[model samples]
Target chain A: MIHVVRKLFWDFEKEEQWLNEMSAKGMALTHYSWCKYVFTETPKNEYTYRIELLDNVPTHPESIAYIRFLEENGVECVSSYVRWIFLRKKSSEGAFDIYTDLESKIKHFKRINTLWNSVMWLEFIVGLANILIGVTNYFNSSSSISLVNVILGGLLILLGLVFLRAGAPIRKKIRKLQQENLIRE
Target chain B: MPESSERGALTEAVFYILLSLYTAMHGYAIMQNVKDLSHGRVDLGAGTLYGAINTLLEKNWIRAVEGEEGSRRKEYEITELGKTVIQGELIRLGELIANGKRIAGGESK
Candidate 1:
């Protein structure tokens, strides 16, 4: 059972659309709280979902539209205890469990991550090396030679910035997906 | 105009995507081709790969073709524009390799 808290910042249309699509595809769901919903059935029977949608702005049209979408699609089982979506296996005789090939994919993600990390570290080392060389040249050489130090310093700074710009997002995405996989297991 | 400028304009993933589409493949096929061609060096996530495919479709570099039902997915083919980009990339890479060889004093034969 995995629970994720999502603050409803945008119009609920997107969330509503996803829920409706999932429901149309056949998944049993129950709305436990104003902010909490649960899915009892999924491709993986071992999974459950709990989401907390915080209304950042109560009067926003997006928020109202989301509430409306939920209202239009959900059926009330009891006063507030309605099952928004319900999913059950069509037949109890067949295998309902999903066998995943995600492990190998995750391993490959780790390999990409390692390569990116090494590149970033190497970039940092190269920047530091250039900076050291720049400073050494600046102090021990003529004015004309010192101009080269200025160029090297600028190049190192640009290189460091570029490496950080490219590597950070890749690292974050890989880490989040890795966490998701770990949580699922 | 310069080799680095051209290479910098296109990423390794974008390069692979364009190269794979040259043979006219589907989303899943392109993903499989990237993995196979890179010898497992690149493995794009389904979400990311699909996102890239959609972007390429919007850019008009790849067009989707109807595929048969059951086990077959929709196919995509590279457009003339896509071919031009691939051609430019090849020339850029060639120039880079040639320049590098010269700098390393291996340009003699």
Candidate 2:
């Protein structure tokens, strides 16, 4: 049986956990695109899922090499969205963790932190530009278009603030990992 | 100065990886070799191994072997410079062991 689920997640870790939960319920994720997921029915606990953000787009040579390496190691690449890849291995494979050391874990979180930081800045710049244009339009001639632009600009800024807030936990994770790295590896 | 800077201690993963690549092995073979060499102490995850391999390649510590055309599995081997670095590390480890044994006063176990 095939099942399709429509959902969105900004937190990769949470998404991984949710996918594992779905697998536990006998739904093995077969594909993913943006906010959509497709699954095939399978025996419960047949697979373990992991989500990783590649350092480059999936088609990039480096990314392809990395994926091929994972495949050689028994991890299957199920799907990709932008730079993020969904991976899985048989549940009986004995703890399929992609990062086994403190340094690697720290590096992974730092990558995620950099991503969120870029997103927040991009939203802020675009939002500020829209607000500036809307204000100029309003002053030049009063119109509903100006009001609509102002409203949309305000919403974008608000979304930017949300992204900024979302990045806090990732930053906190990086800090914690760095502290641990200092004491250990 | 760059050579001196590179003399700093290597991470456990890098050390094992370089050691494993001395014989020109592919990725999965390298992982297994590391695990066996460490007596199951140091296991390299695929992602971590990929990152370390890239760094080593950039540093010219390891080079890809020219395999038969169209071969999907690529092999890597340690460079001469990499051998020098690992040898330096061995001497450093030996000194540390000798110092600890002299001060701690324990039989070599």
Best by DockQ: 2
What candidate 1 gets wrong by more than 4 Å, as runs, is A1-185, B1-8, B69-72, B104-109
Off by over 4 Å in 2: B1-5, B66-71, B101-109
Worst 10 residues of 1 chain B by lDDT: B1-10
Q: Write one digit per residue (lDDT tens) for candidate 1, span B3-106.
A: 32233345566678888987777665676698889997675544345546666778776788776566345678888777777788888899888888879756
**What is the per-residue lDDT of model 2 for residues B1-109, given as tens digits with 9 covering 90 to 100?**
1463565678899999999988998888998899899998887888989889988998888999975578778889999889888999999889888899898857656
What docking tier does model 1 reach?
incorrect
Model 1, residue B15: C-alpha shift (Å): 1.4
DockQ of each: 0.02, 0.71
Give Cα distance to truth, residue B34, candidate 1, Å: 0.4
Clashing pairs in 1: A11-A62, A27-A86, A27-A87, A28-A86, A28-A87, A29-A85, A29-A86
Candidate achieving the largest TM-score = 2
Please write out the lDDT profile of model 2 over residues A16-129, one tens digit for every residue: 999999999999999999899999999999999999988899999988878988998899999998889999999997677898888889888888888888888888888888
DockQ of 1: 0.02
CA-lDDT, candidates in order: 0.52, 0.88
